[model samples]
Target: MRGPEARPRFGLSLRLLALTLVFVLLAEALVFLPAIGRARVVYLEQRLAEAHLALLALEATEDGMVDGDLQRRLLGHAGAVAMTAYQSGFFRLRLGPDMPPRVDAAYDLREVGLWPPVGDALMVLTRSQPRLIRVAGISPKDPRVAVEVTLPEAPLRRDLMRFARRLLGLSLIVSLIAGAVVYFSLARLLLKPLSRLVAAMRRFEAAPEDPGRLHTPSTARHEVGEAERTLARMQARVREGLIEHARLAGVGAAVARINHDLKGILTTARLESDRLEAQTRDRDPDLARTTEGIAQALDRAVALCAATLSYAGSELPSARPRRLAAHHELTLAAQRLHQAHPEIAVNLDCAVDTTLSADPDLLARSLDNLTHNAAQAGARHLTLAAHTSNHQTTLTIADDGPGLPQRARDNLFQPFAGSARNGGTGLGLPIARELTQAMNGHLNLHQTTPSGTTFHLTLPT
Candidate 1:
């Protein structure tokens, strides 16, 4: 047995066909009702006209009468068993035998309403046995006089049934032709394009990384066409993202290998720097200072290598939470910032002596990244301020820099794409944010304008 998706069933074509057929039949039925009624009326009127003409012939005779044989012939020609003519409020002529046993129904041809003829016609059609009906109308030749006739309902019913059958057959033919035309037209215009889109989506889903599997959208300027265009654009973006991910994966592998070898080299250089420092401490102070600078640079290099390795391995260094005085951490970061960029002025203002619960090293590293970024942006004056509010310690770092560019601000904190300065890897801010988050702290760029830029760092106190 086939599943629901695999089962074959009626589609839009069949549905449209059935709908068209039903609508056409309904329309024909509406026309048939009034048409049958009108047919019955016309039949009675024709019989009355024949009877009137026969009466005229009888009146033309000298005695205003006809032989029995001639009378029978006239009534047979009019298709009525009996007929009477009245002129000037007097009976002028009478034909055929006496009145029938009973009249099943009576109709006034001069009746004004729409439903009377229809009702009479329905009575005729529904009668179980042949009926004798009486029809009265003004004579066509003489408007002042009236003619009456009695006719069997069987003939009229037969004619109406024949007409109905022909109409039904014609309606079926027209519906079939119309449904075919509509089905093919819509199938080509709508269903075919939709089917193509579905097939394309399935193929793309099966192999999303394959750029060639993406759909080529239709150029039609319709709603369906717009959907196709949107899907195409989305598929393009997805493909680009996949390609970028693959490239990043490769770069990560290369960085991991470099970090492994470079760590050993930095360790050796650190040992040599320490040995040189010990030897020169008793001799030249300038040489000792230079060795100390070399040792500091080596330490920074090793830290950066470790950070890169950690990021590449998708493992952020876990934070060891501790309580530390906010003022002390701020002063230390400020002193380091000044040492790194001595030409830049530093101002530290701590109005709150708050102890913050966070990883001290991680907090200091985030502050260092923010200050170093400010210095690199040609900032001349850097201000570090701290305050405690609602059991939270907020640190504000403002700088008199040219401010970040719009592109950098948009992609800020996104690794490899957010670098503001040339020849700089865009990893600093993202790593800072990662470290801040691990310490349960928040870091954000508060504002950036032509005059300056500011950063906000918040930690629990």
Candidate 2:
């Protein structure tokens, strides 16, 4: 019965695209942090160098100092309110106002590490208000000289903001590019093929018996290809099984339709044979025995026909379980085997005379089927061994029949298709196993090898 078709709430391709963009942005952040820090350091150094050049203006003057108006102009050009320089402890230069408020924050650019600049850069971006910051660095003109500059943080912050915006814009572009690349790689390689497989499965599920609905596998060498190939093989096998079962169903229907006619013929034969036996009873004693044999054979044929009918209907008579002596039952089974195949030796081994709860008729029929099958398989000797333990009785029927063939082992207990020998019914083991199950027991093909085959039948005791 069909209920509803399925739809993905969130498509896999979309999820892949979203994740690709997110990961790309994360990667850009990693590149941006250190890059922004390095940029900040460069800006500070550039200001210090400009401040150094402005102090050189004082050096140009005869008194190593400049007028107030000229100092203000130099400070404005250097983008710092104050500048100081010291060299060889003799040459000292200071410019701008005497004091530039109280210093708020200080930085040393001479630190030889990445983390410090990164930390300072992050703090600068997150700060709500700007402050006057002092930056000290080695002098660009002379190695022994040291230069320092004090400037408002507002200009530095503005330059950083502009760089960040541009970097973010480029990151967005890169994210789109990366997402597109992933779509081509992951979506086409994985998602598309998986989607095809899902669609094929849905179509097959709708009409499984339709051979045309089978999926066609692609030639890509990947997990998706392997899955497609596996699905293709599975679909082919399931179709074959369904076809085989359909043929079996047709055979069953045909057998059912002919059942009445077959029954009538067997009944007529039995009655005629019985009459012949009665008429020849006193006339010819020897002929009477032959006629009696004919009647008994006809009775067997009729019973076999009934069994066939029941098998075709997939049912069995209700089992009547009762406690029976195990040794006695084994002896009876051995006798039946000997009678059926007089050439075959029948061995009965029951070390302990245990009690078993099983239907006598079902157990007898199952054993007959087993022994008869063994005989057909070239078995000359059969063992009916019984062992009881833990309230369970295990009856093993072993036969030296050159073991079972590969085909028989592969399709063991499969009705109509299990027989290894030509002209065999193939229903013997299946019928016997079904009967054993009806009697609340199990019949298993325990082992088969080149030497012999063992069938284990377990029943409650």
- For 118-237, candidate 1 gives per-residue lDDT tens digits of 777777778768888888998777798899988777888887778767866787787778778877887888878888887788788778799889999989999889989999999999
Model 1 ranges off by over 4 Å: 1-8, 87-90, 99-101, 112-123, 140-144, 221-227, 241-461
**Residue 458 miss distance in model 1 (angstroms):** 26
Relative to the true structure, candidate 1 reaches a TM of 0.53
Clashes of each: 0, 0
Q: Weakest 10 consecutive residues, lDDT, candidate 2?
A: 299-308
Positional deviation of residue 454's Cα in model 1 after best superposition, in angstroms: 20
The lDDT per prediction is 0.84, 0.86
Instruction: Give the winner by lDDT.
Output: 2
Clash pairs of candidate 1? none
